[model samples]
Target: MMAALRRRDFLFGSSLLLASPFFMRAARAASPRIISLDYGLAQTLIEFGTPPVGLIDTPGWYDWVMEPPLPPGIANVGSNYEINMEMLQLLQPDLIISTPYLEWIRPQLETIAPVKSFPIHAVGSSPYPHIIAATLELGQIVGQPQQAQALIDRTERDLLAAKAATRRLAEQKLAIMTFMDARNIRVYGPGGIFQDVLDRLELQNAWTRRTNEWGFSDAGLADLIGIGDSRIFYMDPVPADVLAGLAGSPLWQAMPFVQKGHAQRMASVLMFGALPSVSRFARLLAEVKV
Candidate 1:
C-alpha cells in the first residue's frame, strides 16, 4: 500500500511539472508591449505594474504631481505631438495608448500599431471617472485587469479621504488660473480639471464666464480683474520678473482679492487643466497651504 501511494504522488508531481511550461507560456503571452502617448496613460501603466516600453514626455514622470520617476530602462519617444516615428517603428509595440484629443495624429500612429484613445477631457467626462475607465480599458488591452482594479480602488479611497479632510473648508470660493508669459493669462472656467477639483471640495469657481471649447479662456490683466472677487489660486510657477510686473501693474494691484492677499501661487501640475488621476489631484490639494 505504501509503495502504491508513493507512485501516485510521484505521478501527480510529474504531471504538474509537465503542465508548468504551458501555463508559463500562456502567462507570458498575456502581457503586451505598449507605447503610451499621454502622460496620464503612462502613469496608469506604472500603476498597473506594466510600464510602457516607450513614453512621450519622460520628464513629466518626475515633475508630475505624483512625482514617481520613470524606470531607467524605459525609452523616451519625444513630445506627445511629435512622437519619434523611427523609434516607434523599431520598437514595434503591440499597443499604442493616447487621448482622444490627439485623434489628428491617429492616422500616422495607426500605421505602426493598434491605437486606443480615451476621451479624458470630453464634454461631461469627469477626471476621476475618465482615469478609472482609461486604466481599466488599458488593463484589458494589456492583460492587467486585477492591477487596474486595485489602482482604481486605491484612487477612490484616497480622493474620499482628501475630501473628508477638507470638508470644513468647502465653502471657500476658489479661482485657478495661469499666467501666460507676461502679457496673457489663461483661466479655467466651468467643466475643467480645476473646476472639478473645486467642485469636489464643494468650493465655487469665481469665473462663471464661458471658456473656449477646451475649457480655458485667455484674458489680459484688465480682463482678469473682471472675472470675480474669489480668492485666486494662480497655477504654474511664475518667474520673479513676472511677479514684479504683476505687482507693479495698477490693474493687478487694485484687484480686491490681490490687495487683500487672497491670491496664492500653485505649482503647475495639470498643464492645460487636465488632472491625470486622483493621486495627482490629491497631491495638488495636499500641497495647497490655504
Candidate 2:
C-alpha cells in the first residue's frame, strides 16, 4: 500500500511507456507500406484513408486528381516508367502496386518488393466491373473491406444523384477532350472510363469514332468540326502556348460548339482513373450551367 504513490513519482519507470501520438501517426504512415505506380490505383488507396507510402509523381497528384487531398510523409519515387531505384530501396515498401500499362516493368518492381497489378483496362472491356473488383481486392490488401463496400455504395449513390442533377443535360450530346498541344486532341469515346461514366449517367457521347482500349483517339480541331452542335468539355491545364495557339486558330473559333457557345472548360479530371474519377466526372457534368 504505497497509498497511490504521488504522480510523477516513477515517471522514468512507469508501466505506461506507450508511444506518443506523433510517433504513432508516423508508424501508421509506414506500416504495411504500399507504393502505387498508377494514379488511379493510388486514388483507391487514398479513398480507403491509407495512402501509399510512396507513389509516382506525388507532386502532380493534386494537379490531376484534385481532391481527397494526399496525406503527409509519402515519398516520391519518380516517374511511372522511370522509378528511382535508390529511392525505392530507401522507402522499403511492403507492397508495390501497379497497372497493366506498366506490365513491362512489373518484374523490376518485384525485385524490390511484392508487386500486385490491379489489371482493370487490359481486356478492352467496360471498366466498371474491373474497378469494382480492384477496389474490393485492394480493400482486402489494406484490411479495409467494410470501407471498400462503403466506398462502392457511396460512388453509386453519388452517381445516381448526379444523374438526377443532370436530367436535362442528358438530352444533350457531350464530348470530353484533352488537348495534346493546340494541334492534336484526345477525344474520348467508347471502351474507356469516361465513356463508362457517360453511360452510367444516361448521357450521350458525341464522338462515336473508334477509340483505343484506354478510350480516346488523337484528332485535330478540323476533325471535331464534324460533330456539329455537340457540347464540348475540354480538360484544362492545357499548355499555355497551346492554349494561345488555339485562341488564334480560325478553325478553333469556327467549330459548331464554339460558335453556339456550347464549349466548356472543365478542371483536369484523370480521364483514365477508376471509381474516384467516375464520381468526379459525374459531379463536374452535373454542375455545368449548360
Candidate 3:
C-alpha cells in the first residue's frame, strides 16, 4: 500500500511539472493583454516600457507619433474608423484601452475584453492634468505605477532643462501651426496641449484668436496675417504640393512674417499627444532658436 501511494504521488508531481507551462500561460493571459486603440496611449505605454499587445493604424502611428517607438511584433488591430474585431478576438486580450474618439465602437470592444476608456481631451478639463492622471492610472492597471511616476519625473526634469535653456526667449510670442495645404492651416492656440507646454515654460502664444474646444483654429492665410511678426513656427511633413504652391504664391510671399524672415519649419510633432510628446515639443522649441 505504501509503495502504491509513493508511485501515485510521484506521478501527480510529474503531471504538475508537465502542465506548468500551460498553467503559466493561462495566468499570464489573465494578467491583461492590453490593446491601446489610441496613439497617445500607445506612446504613453511604450514610454513606460509596456507595449500593448494591439493598437490601431501602426503605420500612421509611426508617421505621426514617432517618438517612444513601438516595439516589434505589436499587432495592428485596424484603423480608427473600423477596428479589425476578428483580429482583436484572436489575440484574446484581457483589456482594451481606448478614448472617447472610439465611443461608437466601445460596445463591440467591450464585448471582447473589459474596455477602459480614458478621456484624453475631455470636455471642460485641460489635457495636462488628464495626461498625468491617466499615466498613473494606466500604470496601476498595468502593474507599473513606479515606471509611470519615473517617466513623469524624467519628463519634468527635461522640460525644466529646456525651459532654462530658453529663459531669455521665454517671453517671445510664438505662433505654431501645421499646414494641411498651401491655403489651409491649423494653428495651435490657447487651451491646446502646445499652449499648456508653452505656459509651463513661461512662453507666450502669438495667436490670441479664439479656437475650438480642441484648441486650434482652422483658417486661411488671411487669419494668420494677424500674428504680426511673432515668430512663426510651422510643424513639418508639409505636403510637397503645399510647399511648392506656397513658394509661388504672391500672398504667401507678401505675408509680414514671411517677408521679415520670421517663418521657420520644425519636424513633425503630434498636436494631440501625451507627456513624452510634450517634452519632445519643448526640446524641439529650445533647440530651434527663433
Candidate 4:
C-alpha cells in the first residue's frame, strides 16, 4: 500500500510540473511587438516608452516634431506612402498600425500581421479628442491601455494650462502660413491643424477660406494683406539669407502687417498630423507675447 501511494504521489507531482508553463502562459500577459506606420502613432509609442521596432518615413528635415532623432536600432520600413513589404515581413512584428489614408496598403500588410488604421485627420473631427482616441486605441492594442489613458490625461492638462496662460490675448487674430516652396506660400485656413490650436485659444484665424486636402491654400504675398491689422504667423523656417531676400522684396516689405510690426516668424513646428507636433505648437503659443 505504501509503495503504491508513493508512486501515485510522484506521478501527480510530475504532471503538475509539466503543466506549470502552460498555466503560467495562460495567466501571463504577452508583450506585443508592434510596427508603427504613422509618425503620430510612433510619437505616442515613444511617449509610452515602447518605441516602435520599425517605422515608415523618418526624415531629418523635420526637427521640430521628432527632435533628438529616433531611438537607435529602429529600422525604417520605407517612406510614408510607400512601405517596403520585404523589410516589414523580415521584422516579424506581431501588429501593424497605420493611418486611414494608407488603407490601400492594408491588404498587403495584413498578410504579415493584424493591421489597424485610424484617420489621422478625420473630416469635421476635433483634433484633440481624435488624437486622444487614437492613442487610447493604440495602447489597448499593445496591451498598455492604462499607460495610454495616463498619457492622454497628461497631454490634456498641459494643453489646458497653455490655453489658460494665453486666454488674456484670446482676441488676438493670428495667421499661420508655410512656404509650399520658394515661389509659393500656403496659409492654414479653416479645418487646418493650426486652426484647431487657434480655436482652442479663441484666437481668430486671419485666413478664413477653405484649405485644400493638405489643409492649406496657395497664395501670393499680397493675399496676406487681407488680415488688415491682424498678426501674421509664418510657420516655416526662413534662413538668414531668405530673410534678407524677403526684406529686399518690395511686395513683402510693403505688406500692411509687416509695416505695422504685426508680422512674426514662428519656428517651424511640424504641422503634420501628430501629438508631439501639437505639443510643440502649444509651447510656442505659450511663449509668444501676443
Candidate 5:
C-alpha cells in the first residue's frame, strides 16, 4: 500500500512541474511594459511598483516632482507636448498611460501602443479618490494588488495624522499661490488639489475667487490684498532676482499678510500630483511654524 501511494505522489508532482511554464507565460502577459506620457501617470506607475519603461520630460519631472526618484536608465521619451515617436517605437512599450489633457493625441498614441487615459482632474470630482482608484488600477495591471492596497492604507493613515496635527490651524484661513512673475501669481482655489488637501486637513482656503478648470487663477499681487489676516504659502522655484525684486517692491511689502508676518514661502510640491505629493505638502504645512 505504501509503495503504491508513493508512486501516485511522484506522478502528481511531475505533472505539476510540466504545467509550470504555461502559468509563467500567463503571469508575464499580465504585466505589460508601461510608458507614461506625463509626470502624474509616471509617478503613479512608480508608486505601484511598476516603473514605466520610459517617460516624457525627465528634467521637468526632477524639478517639479522630486520624490520617489526615478530608477537608473529610464529612457526619455520626449517632451510632454512633442513625444519622440521614433524613440517611443524603439522602446516598444505594451501600454501608454496618459491623461485627458492629451485626448487630442490619443489616436496617435494608440497607433504606437495601447493608450489608457485616466481623467484625474474631473469636474465635480475629488482628486484624492481619483488618485486612489488610479493607483489600484495600475497595481492590478502590474500584478501587485496587495502592494497597492498597502500604499493606499498607509497614505490614508498619514493624511489623517497630518490632519490631527494641524487641527489648531483648521480655524485659520490659508492661501496657497505660485509665483508666475514679479507682477502675477497663480492662486489655488476651490476644486483644486491643494484646496482638496486643505479641506482634508479641516483647514479653510482663503482664496474664494473663481478659477479655471485646473483650479488656479492668474492674478496680480493686488488681488491677494483681499485675503486679509491669513497665512499665505507661496510655492518655490522663484528666481532669485524675482525674490530681490519682490523684496524691494513696496506694493508686495504692503500686503496685509506680509505686513502681519503671515506670508511665507513653502517647499515646492507638484500641486497636481498624487499621494506622495499630497502627503508631502500636508506634513510640511503641519510642521511649519505659523
Candidate 6:
C-alpha cells in the first residue's frame, strides 16, 4: 500500500513539472527562432524582450531607430522589400514577421517557415491603435504577453507626462519637415503617426495640405509661407548639398521660421517605427527649446 501511494504521488509530480511555467518557457526558448522582415516589427520584438534572430538592413538602424540599438548577433538579411532567400534558409528561422505590404513575398518566405504579417498603418485612420494591437499580437506570438503589456503601459504614461510638460508649445503651431532636396521638403500632417502624437500632446500641426498614405506632403520652400509664423522642426541628417543650397537660396533665407530662428533640427528618429517611435517623438517634443 505504501509503494502504490508513492508511485501515484510521483506521477502527479511529473505531470505538474511538465505543465509548469518554467517548463513552458524552456520549451519556447528552444523552438521558434524568429526573423523579422519589417523594421517596425523588429523594434516591437526587441522591446518586448524577445529579439528576433535576424532582421533587414541592420546598418540603417543607427540612422533611423537610433534608440534601443540593435543587439549584436542579429543577422542583417538585406533589403526589407526583397530579402535574401538563401540567407534566410541558412538562418533556419521558425517564424518570419512582416507587414501587409510585403504579402507579395509571403509565398517565398513560407517556403522557409511560417510567415505572419502585421500592420500598424491604415490608409484613412490614426495608426496608434493599430500599433498597440500589433504589439499585443506580436507579444502573444513570442509568449511575452505580460512584458508587452508593461511596455504599452509605460509608453502611455511617458506620453502623458510628455504631453503635460509640452503644453507650453500648444500655441506655437509647429510644422515638422524633412529636407527632400535644396528646394523641396516633406511636411508631416494628417494621416501620419507624427500628427497623431501632436494630437495627443494637444499641439497643432501647421501642415494642412494633402498628404500621402504615410501622412507627409511634398512642397517647395516658398509654399511654407502658408503656415504663417509656425515654428519648423526639421529632421536631422539633412543632405550636405541641400544645406548648402538652402544657405545660398534667397527664398530659403526668407522663410519666417529661419529668420526668427524657429527652424531647428532634431536628432534622427524613425518616422515609420512602432510604439517606441511614438514615445521617442514625444520625448523629443518635451525637450524642444520652443
lDDT of 3 by residue, 103-157 (tens): 8988898788767788877344468888898898777655566788998998899
- Give the better candidate number (1 or 3) by TM-score: 3
Poorest stretch of ten by lDDT in candidate 1 = 17-26
Residues 135-238, candidate 5, lDDT per residue (tens digit)? 77766656666777887887788789999889877767999998888888999976667887888888999998988777788899899989997999988877
Q: Given candidate 2, what's the lDDT at residue 211? A: 86
In model 1, which runs have C-alpha deviations exceeding 4 angstroms?
1-30, 60-66, 124-127, 271-276
In lDDT terms, how accurate is model 1? Answer: 0.67
lDDT of each: 0.67, 0.79, 0.78, 0.69, 0.77, 0.79
Q: Mark the regions of model 5 whose C-alpha exceeds 4 Å error after superposition.
A: 1-30, 122-124
In model 6, the Cα lDDT at residue 225 comes to 86
Q: Please give the lDDT score for candidate 3.
A: 0.78
What is the alpha-carbon lDDT of model 2 when measured against the actual structure? Answer: 0.79
| Error of model 6, residue 45, in angstroms | 1.0
Q: Candidate 2 lDDT, tens digit per residue, 1-290?
A: 23223222222222221242322222343235778888888888899998898989989987888766788888899997588978888987767888878889877777877677777874678888999998987776665667789889999998999989988887789999988887888998877888888898889999989888777888986899878998989897788887777667898898989989998889988776878888898899889996
The TM-score between candidate 2 and the true structure equals: 0.88
Q: Please state the error at residue 216 of candidate 4 in Å.
A: 2.8
Model 6, 20-136: lDDT tens per residue? 332343344432478998788888888877798988999889878886778999998989666889889998776788888788888888888777777777456787888898887
TM-score of each: 0.80, 0.88, 0.88, 0.81, 0.87, 0.88
Spell out the clash pairs found in candidate 5: none
lDDT of residue 235 for candidate 6: 92
Backbone collisions counted per model = 0, 0, 0, 0, 0, 0
Kindly indicate the candidate among 1 and 2 with the higher TM-score.
Answer: 2
